[model samples]
Target: MTIATLPAYPPKPRPGDRVAVVSPSAGLPEVFPRPYELGLERLRRDFGVEVVEYPTTRKMAAPEERARDLNAAFGDPSVKAVISSIGGDDQITVLPYLDRELIRAHPKPFFGMSDNTNLLAYLWSTGIVGYHGGAVMTEFGRPGAMHPLTEASLRAALFTHGEHELRPADTYRDVDRDWADPAAFAGEPPMEPGSGWTWRNADRVAEGVSWGGNVEILSWLLMADREIAPDPSVYDGCVLFLETSEDMPSALDVFGILRAMGERGLLQRFSALLWGRPKAWSLESPNSAQEKVRYANDQRAAVLRAVEAYVPSIPVVLDVDFGHTDPQLVIPYGGRIRVDGPAGRVTVTY
Candidate 1:
């Protein structure tokens, strides 16, 4: 069978656009009120966009109801885009209940990551371009204020058009301060010095339609066969972007998943890979400064080993800022991605 070409869904958001914010996953706002409120305020005041919330936007309801809210948002013609309030673990369950025809008929930009990967993949399958970053509560709803990098990236993704070069942020943060404590906004989280992109096996530049998401989430997609095609040719010349979740899967787990992709002939097809910064630690698995550094290094090595074994020529960029970490950058699924392996530059056509 011939593999289908990746669909290109044009960018939709603009300043003064009315975007619908829904909780297709866990309703974190009902639990964590501060960041949720801040996220809403930023959407209105900072971006100059109107924020519309659905009935189940903050309700911890069943997957069917969440899917209903998604359909309602997309069905409304006035809504320019849809943004997730936050991500949850079981968004996979909501897949079966989604109205694919409705979503396809009204393709609008959807922004999210983590568990929202489920929705992103669903939208992609329906020929919609979904962004893979900037959840309402996390990035826009940042406690002290939005990171400069995050704000800049979101602006381009929302209002601007054409080729947007993605530069690595000079510094990054993952830890969250207390949203309830107003004093927590007194200072920004400490950021360590970061280097430019590290390219592996950089021999030539390659450009392709981009795909892939949180590695752990993609594994779930693989298991369910939700959106990912079984044939490797579907991913041929595609730029793959992947990052680990807060679970911080061990190096072995990361290797095993890639090994599975290799076995499926998926690894060898990608033109290039953008590996997101592995969230070294989270609140549950808080590690020392030294340990976090080690963890990130180990994860990188594991990915390199898998690529070397399966797709040695594909250039791999380490520590891209898109995944379970703070100051996340949005990636357009089924969109144009340029990887200049020699110059060590990456640009996305939104």
Candidate 2:
């Protein structure tokens, strides 16, 4: 979309403001109360925001019920912001039930990622910018203390306005512990030294409004013909950011999705691209550290392959700390992003 037609950035919430916790995706909090409670405590203690939960915040209710809670949260003037407990696989099912007119009338800063990309994309279509990180169960309720980088980025996204620079994390963790086990909450997850960000075609600077989210979710959205504009050029001059979930789809799958987007004439419209670090390990696929590195390399290669086919010269930064990786940074959907390849810096206007 052109700058004149870009979505409006919702007002940021203050520390004392009340924020709604809803389950637009999955009610993971019900299955894992310890982490959910911990996340709530941190939201109140660390962030100083009062927590207001909806009916389906902890229960795996029907799609309409989840959508009702979402509408209630946004329609309630007392709620200044809304956050998801966690993301799930079938958030796309919840979209048809949402009251877009209600949400558009009462816009609130919404925070989530993964399956919540459905909501982020919905909000974007409704002319409101939504955050793509800071899910309660994962980031806010992180085992032990929250990651400093994550907290800083979340804080800026929640309370401040204007530009916020994003820095590469020196360390990150992808291996997840069993949230069902109390031991998992005993301390922070183990992390390894990070290789920093990989920049491609970064010889110049590019700035534009940002778009995109979890790659898998975007593919689903495309398949469903959901929130994406019919005109591929709506994303022209936009900064596209994408990440993978814990499902760990093969590199072939990643390339296939991007190839489809390129075939649709959607991939070439962006001025820059930011790829979130892929989660190389999961419970089902507990890859070795070496295997993790190889998986990441393959994923990166798949992305580069697609980039070569479309928008090859655009600035591309990979392995950004977002999505399923530990210490995730909040990326503002439908907000301003400046990608400076020559300066080796990336900044997002919160």
Candidate 3:
């Protein structure tokens, strides 16, 4: 999708604009109100934007309800933007019930990540550029305080229009703290110093529209054939950005999914890739410090193997902060991405 053909990025909302916060996926807000409330508080105090919640924002409701909230939020002139309370696994279910024509007529900036990727991809296909970052419970309500990088990225996406250069976090944390414990909100999570971005085939530059989201989520979309363009050439000059979730699918599993895309002649369509830092630790798969390091290293290798198999010459940047990791960047769905290997810079047009 070229800039001309890609959806027009919806207008950025003003500081006093009312923004809708809905749960288009699982209602973790139902169980974990601490983070959700803190997130909403920040939306008002920090962002100076009024927050609006729907029936399903903090409740486990039907997909139909979630879609209706989205319609109402976008259809209302007072509501300038909409964001998710958090992402969930069943956002794909809500997609079927969404009215594309209604949404197409009332395009508003939508911010989210993880399984909200379903909605981002859906919005992209329907001719709207969605923000692939800023889930309320996660990024905004990060314990202690939000990361400066995350705040800057979110603000630029919400308030400005221009090309922004993406940078690797000086430090990052992939581990999670139990939200159920009030103590968890008392301090920031541990952070490890970053080694910076790893680049391959870094002799040239590639510029195109950015595509792809959570790697595992993309596998789901591929299987469902929901919003992915059928023609290979549709992504001919795209920059594919992908990341994994806290589930931390095995290195082999990672390769298998990318390999499937490779076999379908999909892997080679992009001129470059922005591979996000893999989330290596979760409550269920808690690993030793050494194991976490090894997990990230192994997944990086798996990603390289798949890319090497089909697109060895394309520039690939690894460890970009755009997925489940802390201090994440807001990537523009169906927006321009410039990967300049020689300059060692990745600039995104928002």
User: Per-residue lDDT tens digits of candidate 2, residues 1-350?
Assistant: 22236788998889999999998999989999988999999999989999999889989899999999999999999999999999999999999988888998899999999999999999988899999999999999999889999999999999999999999999999999999999999987898898899999989999998899999999999999999898777888999999999999899999999999999999999999999999999999999979998999999999999999988999999999978998899999999999999899999999
**Of 1 and 2, which scores higher on lDDT?**
2
Assess candidate 2 and give its TM-score to the true structure: 0.98
Model 2, poorest ten-residue lDDT window? 1-10
What is the C-alpha lDDT profile of model 1 across 140-226, one tens digit per residue? 887668988889888888776678888887887766566667776576677767656688867789899888898888888888877
Candidate 3 ranges beyond 4 A from true positions = 1-4
- For model 3 the local lDDT of residue 271 reads 90
> Of the candidates numbered 2 and 3, which has the greater TM-score value?
2
Clashing pairs in 2: 1-234
Cα lDDT of candidate 3 equals: 0.90
Compute the lDDT of residue 219 as modeled in candidate 1. Answer: 89
Best by lDDT: 2
The TM-score that candidate 1 achieves is 0.96
